[model samples]
Target chain A: MRDELLELVMNKATGRASDEDLRRIDSILELEPHLWDDYNQWHQEIPALRGVICLAAATTEHQHQLPEQIRMKLRARMRTALSRSQPNYDRLMELVNTPPDPQLSWRWAVTPAVSLVAIVVISLVLFNNRPDAESAAQTEVANNQPSEATVSIAPVIQVALLDTVGVTRGADDSTRSQFQKAWPAVEVRQFNSSAEFRDWFIQWPAARGSVCKIFYNQGSGELKLIAKINGEEKAATFALKNDVSELSQIIQQAQARLVEWMQ
Target chain B: MNYPPIERLQSGDSEAWDIVFEWLWPKAIYISRQVLTPLAPSDAEDVVIEAFTSLFERIHKVYSTESLPSLLVAITRNHARSHLRKLSAIKRGYSKTIPMNIVLEEQLPSQEETPLESLATEELFDLLEQIRLELPERTARYIHEYYIEGLTRRDIAECYGVSVHTVSGNIRRGLRVLREKLKYKVICTDDLPFRMRNR
Candidate 1:
């Protein structure tokens, strides 16, 4: 509770406080006059924080060049990585040059063919049910009327398939292509790191309200998948046995479940 | 100076490399110094290099400029943590000395944890310097008297020919300024000096 008050006070000072927060801060200050000293002390520190950040950020512009030795070291490392290409380049090339594993070849070939068929089936269903789709779109449009007139009145279903961490980093090309094939309509975006994905997910404006958020955390050598559709959320966790195959299976399962929920 | 588009950096554009290095390297060093102060300079440099290497491998996913700092810091922090972990493992192999990793990790501030518990006294003093610069001369003096000299409001009021209420108001007003200035950098305030139940 005190933490919440401090947050409110800090927010009020920074001008980020909501009305409720401001009210809370005001009431707290009024009630606990002794606490005012602590508040004053922290409040006074704000300028220093700003100064340090600015000074540090600006100091770089003045005299701090990436030290020559470090730059050289980074360049050499970059050259080495570039020469080697992607970490799995050799493995991928070997897989490409050799015949597909006899056991999986049939499955591999059939996956894309199946996805193509699914895409066609979905398309035909939408086309045949144009009136229904249009009505659904219209209802959606009506529900979002006035403010969203600029949005296309036509109804469209768009789903985003994203990886929160580079859990898919070592995924074989065949796996990637197959996954894309399975979800032809879903727009796929891969996040190579959890931090990158988390930051983007939080700031993503279009994902608010009833949208789906599929989070994948593979940080601790385990795959933890959570699918939040509307207010209901479901999660799965399992130790990743085979990095590539297991991740591929997880993606396929998540895609199937998400597709079911979307349609 | 014209900065290259974020897309170019993501694609391993050679020219964009210089600009990316320039902007991130300093901040990386700053954070590294804070995280690896007791470790060798080489360790901090290694962490920065590791961070950049990871950034390069995953550059394609960095869709925007706004998240660059955060992404860099996260990568740097992870590397630093791992580096410390490795050191701790090595030390445990050889000696009975306390694991340095635990000490370093404890020193590092975590966003998920309470900010107050994590803040070291030196950080507070550093902030005090910033606060002192912005306060009115009289209020700044009083801060030095109260916090530095351990003077009470009554003592300050007696010395300054003001009521205790006036002294409290001056300190509060000065602190309000600091809060406004520092608010952007602060989020979890549970450990803020005034929020302690014992205090």
Candidate 2:
């Protein structure tokens, strides 16, 4: 069967047989079920050979280049071989044309590193300055109240949260009304204990930035105000703690302070 | 309106670059999607940007505008391969379990015909587009011509002024690289229809 197949293939190659003869050769190979595999394998080598010939032709001059007629003959022979051996030519071409994936680039690999570095640096700066922030809050609370004679109460006074909430005395109804109105906007509610504040902060991370403090003048009623903003230290005292009576007044004062800082 | 010349773009024309980016971005993104599967959709965009950046740096020598798609495809493939390599490294180090999204088959252009029984052709195309951006210029062009354009090696050789053998070799080498790079990411080609698999 191998000898017959070889003879048939050679005959077809040499043009001793017609196009019908080539078809007959294929049919014969198809009929010999066992030899079909070997025939197909042998046929597949044609493209590689054709590739080599094409390479040679590209390198050589006109005289050396295979004539068009001969090239045609060679191509026909190669095609016959390829039909049996080559995996689908169209499929191979498709695989070649398919584009590359874009997501795996070097820029992507380094972006996370850059982002991580930025985050770490920012965190370090914030973390290191926390102690100074606490001290500033304490000082602000101590200095918040000027002598009543020196500074008269303004209709809309801005209040900033400097520290933790504690009971304070001597806040009048007008001050309390101003404070209540301001308190909602600040988004912090006064809690009875430090544990309650901690629990609230745990439940709502947004509350961690809140300012809650109590101020008391001996014999005067205690004033407690809570205000929430971002990135401010917890348990910091405010200077306004002494004068602040209502949530509304505190918010108004805080907004004024924010505006002044911006200016 | 008149458009800026490619030579102006080669000379660092920001407007020309922007025009090039706008025109090619969607196609580049589409090619990336066809090649890369392991990467997220966002990563595909990153690959396109990277490819364009590299192209911009070497725009002076890139002879023809027709070559842009092929060049972009190459960059995408190389980038994606690198990404896959990194992902593999991370996987080995962390033993993390990555979830695979099962892409649904896309509807055909004609509403009258039901969608074919195959893997998501669009998704595969998208992955391919992603991978193309990461590949080198020669390899990506070969792949794009052979697979996306459905051109024969002889035809590609004629177009590029190269031998058919060289074209085939380029394609084969490109495919081999892709197969190695995308081995873990791609499902069995046999599972997909010939059209989708070829894509």
Candidate 3:
């Protein structure tokens, strides 16, 4: 509950936290795990919080208008979907278009039958006439899908961080917190020695499509990526001048490469 | 009593859709955007689009004229939920599951839906009115002015001889009270910036 912890948590949550910020957070949390519970509680509350805010809008009829481009985008997407000409949409719709006031009892009685027929009609459409229209629709969706990068859905990449042998091995992987801090959904494990790391690495089932990258710290700031993924061992190495200012830049480039490899 | 141009909407008239869009687009987007947090504004727009797409695909089935707005609201939220579910599933490597063909649960009959969800539009309005009555008069006034009357904080402040901050605080806190009373979660923590940015 410290202000610094809150700041760090928000920075990490909002994807603003640097690796150093993440490490500091890990170190802090390693010392005080209980603080995380309070933060996680608030974090878990967000979905429910979001649900209620929307529910408030629903009940109160909150007024809002999207920007023109967003409106246009949605409009295009809808037109494309309707253009597919989903079969029998008109038939079920005919049943549904009854006048609300006069048909209260009649509508209720028929709803079950209508839903049943609709389900059957939908099944037929999906199974019989669906593949081509759906594929075309999917192509349309992929083409029209928004490329705007948003961090709302956490990244799917699982990262493994390996450092030199001098770092002491502890009860938990120290690197775990660093990776967790770096990416919201990331799972991490660290081994202080090659013996310890290899023991775990040997157990990784290649059949499971597993992949691991070993970044070697060769002399003269040479960065090498040796990955054994799905039984394929591929190594890619590059050298950079190890000037202090450029060290950070080189490390960033190396990290970006590693990220792309993992993905 | 306000109805969309149903004939136009049914006939696939672009103008009908335009009319529907102008009428319900704001409310649909409002409901759609609220549930997507840490999500980009674009994702919320995508949810709105998905909801509209679903409605457009099934416009033939739109039975109740009055239920159209609420139905869109329901569909928008439903799509947002489906979107989040699909996202989590994809994270778990279930990318094979596609949501384009997902059925509209809110549109279909469901037995387990809460009474609140099943409430008619008039009933929901009446429920909100009752909840408003339970709120403190000042809180209710702030909410009414801010939402119903569409008054800006500065306008409300000037009218009530108070600072804009007070108006802002009251409106936000009043909304929280109303929201919590209705069993919803957080309001826009940042306030209605998209709407209130110019104001």
Candidate 4:
């Protein structure tokens, strides 16, 4: 429970806390605000948990296994290392892996080479038979394949954060909440890219709903803002010049368009 | 973990390698994070993974007294310095002088001892020994699985066929005992001196 409280506050300080954690913190605050006080006093120490004494704290010890995603990456790297370390063995196999009998070995080697020559000969025969084989093949493929719905990728502004640890205090969140207030009846969706939102919009069975997707990079201030309301697509790009008022204007413009679209 | 389960590792036993990896992973990552201070935390994981692979290749050469963390701390710091040097070189190539403070939060630490160094491999085992000796066997095991193995109290309870409360209580009791036993030198961070900050 001590570790739990420490982790909660640590997450909050690092700006990584979830909505659930915020609620939990609310309860903890009412019960023991002193805990936050203790956590805050450390200030710089919070990052390192420095000067703080601990015995079996899981996080402090790094006791947990590397998260599964990282472990899988490590496993892939190890597999590569295993393959790389045995290059000599691979070379040895290449030299002596076939039958020891000279005639049999010769046949074994010749069989694959012969088959490859036949394949090349056949390919050449097929290619020489057609004057416009490449274009004909492409047209054949186009005829056979179904037409895919085109998804135009709209470039939007995304705020690329300078410091992940500190995070963008409230620039992205406030902008999102502003639209939410304007579109009280509309469903707000967050997406990483305009293309993703478009793909989802096309697949929506109930495409009649007033659903919208806003994609903000939350760093670098580059955003790919696109909204699809009632199957009508609207997109606008606002370059973040490190100005909050510019971001506000983006919301205002988006809200203005949304109001017109809804009416 | 105090004394590494390295007999098998040194003898080229794969199972032994796993045990060693499991034991050293947390310790190695913890050290790397400390070494890579004022840098992105994500880089710490990569550094430790790299250190583990390096350590694996050179397992035979490792001395009994050598801790992987201590060995890799210098390497991680060196990596950070080299990375910073590259960043500076890039800035210079563009004929722009980015301030050192803007690029780096603090000057890369030198030979000063970090608190993580205090938790040496031997001391960790010695503490484990103390916990085992001081607490009941079941309580000690529960604490070990919960803390070191990263098991939840609920999971421990289900495994033991007891209520979650029982597991929590036992673990809490064990921690309280260790705190009482260690007294001054361990446990509480309450004594950590407060400092005034501009923020």
Candidate 5:
């Protein structure tokens, strides 16, 4: 009876035997009173065994074709066991179907590093160009005066020196020479008022970092000069009544040329 | 109609490959999610997809259909474990280690079980899990899905993008491990039939 019950139980549990096999085991149990303890033990173990069987059957069905009845029974038993023993199928399924977190991926891992490099590069570029940009603006303002009128009259000259001269050793000499040679060719546009000249100076690139304004009275030979270096302004009023030097006229012409070239 | 067997996949019958993929995708995804519970849904999918793509490159050796599930489950577990290793390796300021208990909780069903039943289930799961972790990521995933989650070998092969032969090899290797681990747990010789115990 124990052997028959064992055979029936193993067959039923492994899905190798049919429900009839289980019935056969039940019959053996019914017929033998002494084997009841063993039968009860088998019954106690059935749920876990059934779960394993169901899982195995589900897996085995992929390769070996099982009888439909056996397959159905396994499925039913598995469903019952899994549902009753572990009710978290829905939760597990939901987790399985849930999408993966993108933050953990490699793309996001390097974002901070990438951003830091970008910021540093941008800062270096801006820091290096700031003074060059200011010097260029200052040079532009110095050039915007009328050559005919300013060259003949001695004008009050006000110059503001920069703290540091960022001369790019050999690369900038040619540009400097070019500016010196063009000094004689300077011609400024005539304006009725100093405000007009100031407005035009504001638009000039050289005027961006530094600014200069000249007020000249042809009859009195009086010239008022106001120049700004960086943001600080210096004002000088000069009387050219007694001055007749060629150096003064040359200086005036150079200033006029610088303005014309900038315009 | 000529139904191409698993061995023919490596020779380059794309249609045969497709048929296999269609069968295994859900099971593979299911198994991957079970093993890699800490990963988000998208990450799990990516892991599964990557495993399948890797599997597809070598699908020539799978000779039998019975070994497919085991192969897929093995692959899935290996992939998830590899991901965990990678995560751990890069643990810096923002790294998080998912609790092992939580991972097991997520993977297992959430129902009350008798102590004996739970122990048996745990034993079987532990055996498979250990075997899966030891295999290559793709192979481990194949086994987990096929054996634990019950997906077919053909389906697993297709999903893993491999030929049936390769999938079968994975299954064979996985089953060998499982048999070794589970041998002592078989209390009674009569509890498993000849066919089930033979492997």
Candidate 6:
């Protein structure tokens, strides 16, 4: 929960944490049982987070278009697999030459329809359940759901403070009070040590399948909170001026959205 | 090109196969490139073909079209790992050996995958796309160019007509944003074994 300790952990992870820092971290680990959970969370998140950054970094490059030669090879391979004769090309030619459907053409047109059909057919083939596509659709539906429907998936508030904020009472006490004051009925747990934090997360109530994990990245001076709302992730970022009141306001807004969004 | 129903693939329909290839080839190649960067395009093609061949042979066993993408991805990953293992072996033969873990820095938690790990791969892929789309054009472009295109920090800075520090800062902020968004963990303390219990 200590920012200094976390800095040490990050350095240690990157092989830059000093022996002194490691000793301090070890001491923190012994005293603060719940710190492990936060550490573990950071551990799991960092690599994949960087991997994603690396992945997105790569996506900016050229699109991986299939080469003509490779396409030909794949086609030939397909033909061989299907035991089709060379003259079977007529099937493709005939299909192409066939008159376009007037209704289908007028309504959807060629490119959009083709792309749409390709997406559907490929999706049907590729995934057992198209969670990404379906979840996006569900989010759209969830976003526009009527007040009555919104009442069904009542949101629960669960918050994690990943780093210590130079506050008098520990970050946990302050964070809990902030939430308790806002929505007294919500279940709230404050994690100060690794074990407690990790345990709290591990024991997240089965009934409430979603949670909000909040942390302030001291290095970047940003306050970030992420919510898993019905399997879709929604996140908000605010520039931190090291003011708890400012963070509380941003968190309040996030809580309202979660109430509306959580299914 | 018009693609037939994927169901026909079960009966060895070449046309269906063609359509599936057309639709998934780019993705397969992209996945390969991501997993095995510095891979030549020809090698990427080979990896894709190898995976497709595996699918072709097991078409009958594929009970549903669902999971086909996951299946292809898994196969591609395995092939890429195999390539890495061989590369490691070759490098070992030549000089001081590097551990496979060092060689494959992004080693997955395969042996003891948590429930989160199992779902994280597919989910993260989508989350990354979402984050990219949500990011500013310049920041997103910087990320894509630096990570995807294998551009160095200096190159990206040069390309964007910005300082290297500026480019790095943008990327770092972007990564932090991504990290915050995707950090989903469930700590089931009660499930811990005796050794790890109450540690």
Per-model TM against the reference: 0.35, 0.26, 0.34, 0.28, 0.26, 0.33
Return the lDDT, model 2, position B117. 18
Candidate 1 CAPRI assessment class: incorrect
| Model 2 lDDT per residue over B1-199, tens place | 2446767666554556555554555555654454455554545554444445445544556666645554555455444443444344343532321111000000112212111212132333344444444445565665555554556668889888989888766655554444433432333334331122232
DockQ of 4: 0.08
- Candidate 1 per-residue lDDT over residues B1-199, each given as its tens digit: 5667788765556667777778778767765655567854556776677677766765666666544554665556556655554454344431222222222222333334233223342343334344445665577555445543467779999998999988867766654554554553344355554232221
The DockQ scores of all candidates, in the order shown, are 0.11, 0.08, 0.09, 0.08, 0.05, 0.09
Deviating ranges (above 4 Å) for candidate 2 = A1-263, B1-4, B94-199
Off by over 4 Å in 1: A1-28, A31-63, A82-263, B94-199
Q: What is the lDDT of residue B50 in candidate 4?
A: 55
lDDT of 3 by residue, B23-85 (tens): 777777776666566453446765676577667765777654444665677667666654555
How far out, in Å, is residue B71 in model 3? 1.5
lDDT of 1 by residue, A40-129 (tens): 665655444333332223222222458888888777655544444453433322322333244643554455567769989997886687
Q: In model 2, what lDDT does residue A232 have?
A: 26
Better of 2 and 4 by TM-score: 4
Model 2, range A1-263, lDDT digits (tens) per residue? 56456435533443445678688777877788788754554343333222212211111111222234533432333233223322433332232233323443344435555776998999789767779878687558759866343453222212222111122212323433344455444433443222223233333232322333322111112222222323221121122333323334444555554333222
Off by over 4 Å in 4: A1-263, B1-5, B11-19, B22-41, B53-156, B177-199
lDDT of each: 0.51, 0.41, 0.50, 0.47, 0.44, 0.51
- Candidate maximizing TM-score: 1
Q: CA shift at B175, candidate 4, in angstroms?
A: 1.5
Off by over 4 Å in 5: A1-263, B1-3, B92-181, B184-199
Residue A121's lDDT in candidate 2: 100
